[model samples]
Target: MLEKKSEFTIYPITVLQDNIVWVWVHNCNAVVVDPSISEPVEKWLLEKNLSLKAILQTHHHDDHIGGTQKLIKRWPQAKVVASKKELKRIPFQTFSVGDNDVFHLMDSEIKVIEVNGHTNNHIAFYISKEATKYNILFPGDTLFSGGCGRLLEGTPTQMFESLCKLNSLPKSTKIYPAHEYTENNLKWALTLEPTNLSIIERLKLIQNKLQKGMTSLPSTLSEERKTNLFLRAENIDKFTMLRRHKDSWKC
Candidate 1:
């Protein structure tokens, strides 16, 4: 099995101004995460000769699931995996999952983590194989490179707890968030702690990546620990304050 041999890489497709559609591939099969649109993704997959195996929906938001039905039309065999709790919104879900449910995809173990702050029943997929060097987290709109999603449907406490769960993953875990917001997020963090070298250095690096038209994401948990203010918050009160501040922050 590919799980035993361990071969996979996640490719990012930038779309819809800021949304990033991650495609995890192994042995000519691909699994898409929150495709904001279909044409670009379809062209990329076809060019690579990859077969669509599944689509993982993290939330019911239009930007997240808008391209799903079209992709399904292109590949009727592709499975649409989503939260069972959001059946009404994500009615096309073929594999309805819940928090902590483990499933196999492309020979890797994929665990569903309910991260409800971005939206009620929003989930993240944590993928790992025994021989894999690093675990990969598709955190949809929950945990970003240097920040977290807004409290759209849940409270600060729930968002805090959700982040804690993600933070508990291996330090080597590679975080693949759904947007290219690292530069702005880090810039915002720097405003709070201008003397913090970690934030300053990272912001510079992220800025360079942006200038080069490169993605500064798939950030490791280790990096986030040093640079992401939301990940560094020690308590719920602090998390709440940070959330409120970030919401009103300009950059």
Candidate 2:
């Protein structure tokens, strides 16, 4: 996940509970994803003298879009991008997008992927540039490092299909999930597969990061394929069972 100085750098700003606000930086402009709060993000941008180019909303969850309005108040020109189908829920969206819609921003192309499961219209943003070595996926509360989002508003079949859609992406893609849930997800996975060495090693490495006060994310699809139980689920039935088990799991 190390990068040579490039035109873009997307990283996380950890916030309430486990929510992560992903800020994509390109030159002097910044695009924020799912800002759970505005004060810290606004302060950070102002300190760095970066203009808010846009705000990408993945869903209507309060924790996800809670800061959009407030953020726009400071940078009125910053576009609010969200699901076109959820206009009532996300009324402030300046640019509406749907599944598979491709848009250009900050000199890079972004693909809007409808990953509806955590919520009916939940979406993930993917960015792939010829100038960068790795692609980026900002899966808002949909695909976590070691798990998938809870099916709060969609069926298990819906969530399974969504995960499959994501799994088909190139393995080198870097996933910036909306929460620091890797440690907990891996811990639960270990309970199901006690001898899984991949899970064991990842849990250890992630624990080290947590201990040092770092976010254990920006995981590659390659790493998830090796250790993420949900991603490895062979069928919808298997995925559903794992989802149920994870829902009751305490970690």
Say which candidate scores most in lDDT.
1
What is candidate 2's lDDT per residue for 157-247, written digit by digit as tens?
A: 9999999999999999999988889998999999999999999999999999999999998899999998998899999999999999999
Q: TM-score of model 2 relative to the true fold?
A: 0.97
- Note the Cα lDDT for every prediction shown: 0.92, 0.91
What are the per-residue Cα lDDT tens digits for candidate 1 across 29-117?
A: 99999999999999999988889999999999999999999999999999999999999999999999999999998888999999889
Per-residue lDDT of 20 in model 1: 94
What are the C-alpha RMSDs, in order, of all predicted structures?
2.5, 2.3
Candidate 1 clashes between residue pairs 3 or more apart in a chain or in different chains:
none
Error of 2 at 121 (Å): 1.2
lDDT, residue 231, model 1? 94
Reference-based TM-score of each model: 0.97, 0.97
